[model samples]
Target: MSTPLSLDRIQHAPKALLHDHLDGGLRPATVLELADQFGYDDLPATELDALTEFFRTAAHSGSLERYLEPFAHTVGVMQTAEALHRVAYECVEDLAADNVVYAEIRFAPELHIDGGLSLDEVVDAVLAGFVDGERAAAGTGRAITVRCLVTAMRHAARSREIAELAIRFRDRGVVGFDIAGAEAGYPPTRHLDAFEYMRGNNARFTIHAGEAFGLPSIHEAIAFCGADRLGHGVRIVDDITVDEDGTAKLGRLASILRDKRIPLEMCPTSNVQTGAAASIAEHPFDKLARLRFRVTVNTDNRLISDTSMSQEMARLVEAFGYGWSDLERFTINAMKSAFIPFPERLAIIDDVIKPRYAVLVG
Candidate 1:
């Protein structure tokens, strides 16, 4: 018998996450304690409820720029290595408990340097946390493997430098490099050298595109920067049109994306909160999935969006009436698109994901 497609049940199915942010998933109490410990008293709220509401409110302002405003506090408290380690460890614990077996959590190393640590020190601290988190989660019988995707803020000029940093630690928990920030003016093409550097080093990367911006951003990320994957490529829907009979037509760009099988890291909750999609009901995930686009579900910022992998899948089930098989397909899509080596990705898929999902998708 098949398991019901409920949120609680969904947590038992192994999942792979690719687009989550490290700083954005901090627990409210962690933020508060870190702030108090570090003498950074600029938080807008002292209590948990008020702080949680503050983040949710900022995220729901329907503006990408505004949605990112709450990160100042989380990143502010995370300057020291101890804070980064704590945040990274907790992020794994939360994801592991949510049944995320494999995750590539991302953060900007440059942002943490404001606390007086070097960029290398920042990366080392986070990696150490991930190693410890993996061990602890395994001890708890969850068995999660967490990797890092060092991010370069799109508005900054350190893209090349950060790309190099990702390469230096590629053997460690760091598997990939990424560029993220407000997408209004800072297009991915601005960081061509960084992407080129990754490519030159035979590294993989995904670009933040088609989220707040449009196809132009997507175009540059793919065509110019050679992004291995797209971060929130939801806006590719702009190039598509559906007929009255439900037949969908794909534009050239969309056709290329589909034909190339480039992964679209679609974060539904974060997309809605950031106005990338008007609401969950109107998200293009269903249409894109039906069209055979390499669409994968993700939680861009779990704490900010108040979401988890289970919550993301459950919301899809609620909105589009998806079933367990649908969730399995999305999970497999993420694993297939993971930046890990082909053998490693396949091992997890065949051993962990397929077997666990076989029971849920019975």
Candidate 2:
């Protein structure tokens, strides 16, 4: 067997990420600084280390609702355009440090309106930050590309507006649309109008389904709303039956998901933290990868999960004995599944991803 890749090696490997949250992944020090700058005094901790520990501990509550509680502080500080730009800029710098060559970070533009910034202003500020970050990374000899997915909170009533906003800024670094929030009470079908609007405009979108809920949620996201991808579709494992001798059976939904090549944005650590799965070892990523499903690894919430793409890859390597080739496959799957145009995706794969991985293998 080949040697297991070290954390340093993993950090140096080229990677692609599809399912990361902007507000959910802020640096603890940034959170504290932004909070102080904005005069928001409801933080759970004062110092940076304690604030970091508080977020990590709070996210381990095994309840999705509780897992999302820390966002209030992050969002509280992100009301101004400057705060949004700084957060977006630092997100790129952090991802570049971890060697994520391509990433699509998602955030709700509607969430930053409390300080009187328009949705357009919010999108422009974040886009400017991405442009600046990419240029800075290039100067440092790291060619990282970043984009945005404008998200709408599912429990709210602004999905259609968010979808239109996403379409309005598609060429300006906003590549897709999404809806994310508590999944128990507010279903994906509630935003059918928004999905239809995106489809009508030929825009790409992914839905947060099969997480904190069950099969029906996945079914609606696919069958009814026509999701381009399933965010945390890990719960689709419920439809698969593994026999004693390792025979596998796929139910109708699972079969359809596999047959259609729908991407599953599997975030293993975040899944375990949210009680979506028992543990990292028990995550459906292994089974789904074995099944030849379009599975991609992700750090759903870097801060809350206390993870990076390298960290996620290392955990999978330890759990399933995955090798460098396996990591390459996941990276390729993510690139293919990105919401960018076909030719750009091909260029990234052929020019950036393949060459980088070949050097690593050599």
Candidate 3:
């Protein structure tokens, strides 16, 4: 067996994150500070240590409702423009510290309306935060670029409005649209009008499918809704079959995914936490990687999963016996799958991510 790779070494490697949630990754201290500013005492814990404990407990419940509970607190404190800007700025700072070179942070703008700010105002605040964060990181000789993905609540009825909001801010900072929230009862097909509109405008989009649901959801998102990428498409494993001699047979769906080159944003720890996979040891990331599927690693919710890109890569290294080459492949997959313009993506691959990895493996 190969010697296990050191997590600390991987921590310094360049990384990209595509599936993180804004509401799901607030710093505990920031949450407490924001809560105090708003005069809200509904927090389960007042102190930072206790607050961290509360969040850990809430996330480990493995129930979707419990996992969503912390968002209420985070969102409650993020109603005002100032609060939103602070949180978004801090998110970028944290990602830079973790050595992430590029990230696409997503949030549902509709969730931040308690202070009567319009949807545009909320997005503008977050965009301003990213701008500030980029400047701040540059001061420390490290830089990170952030793009916003406006998400629509799947169970809600504002997808069309949210899609339009994404298109409106496309030139500013918003790069793409997504549909988030509970995936069981709320199908992606419900937002067909929004997807159609985005398509008409030549906008890009990714759909959260096959995470909590199954292959049917993925099929609808791609075929019916025209998703450019598949978020947590892990459940597509259900479409595969194992032969008697340990050979794997690609089902029709798996073959299609491979042939079409659709990227799978696989979040290992979060998938395990959400019961989407049996365990990290049994995750299909290795299988998909071996099968040449376009797979990328991500931290779906850093706070909820208690993960960073470094930690996720460390786990994959341990679980799948992956080497630095595998890590490079994952980064290339993310760069290829990103919703950014072709020139920007090419610059990242050639000038930033690839050069960093080349030095690492030298």
The deviation in Å at residue 112 for candidate 2 is 1.0
Clashes of each: 0, 0, 0
Q: Rank order by lDDT, top first?
A: 2, 1, 3
Off by over 4 Å in 2: none
Tens digit per residue, CA lDDT, model 2, 1-362:
36888899888899999999999889999999998988989999999889989988988988999999989999999999899999999999999989999999999999999999999999999999999999999999998999999999999999999999999998899999999999999999999999999999999999999989999999999999999999999889999999999999999999999999999999999999999999889888999999999999999999989999999999999999998789999999999999998999999999998998999889
RMSD of 3: 1.1
Question: RMSD per prediction, one decimal?
Answer: 1.2, 0.8, 1.1
RMSD of 2: 0.8
The TM-scores, one per candidate, come to 0.98, 0.99, 0.98
User: Weakest 10 consecutive residues, lDDT, candidate 3?
Assistant: 60-69
What residue pairs are clashing in model 3? Answer: none
Q: Identify the runs in model 3 with alpha carbons over 4 angstroms from their true place.
A: none
Worst-scoring 10-residue span by lDDT in model 2 = 1-10
Candidate 1: lDDT over CA atoms? 0.93
- Model 3 residue 361 CA deviation (Å) reads 1.1
Task: Please give the ranking of all candidate structures by TM-score, highest first, separated by commas.
Answer: 2, 1, 3
Higher-ranked by lDDT: 1 or 3: 1
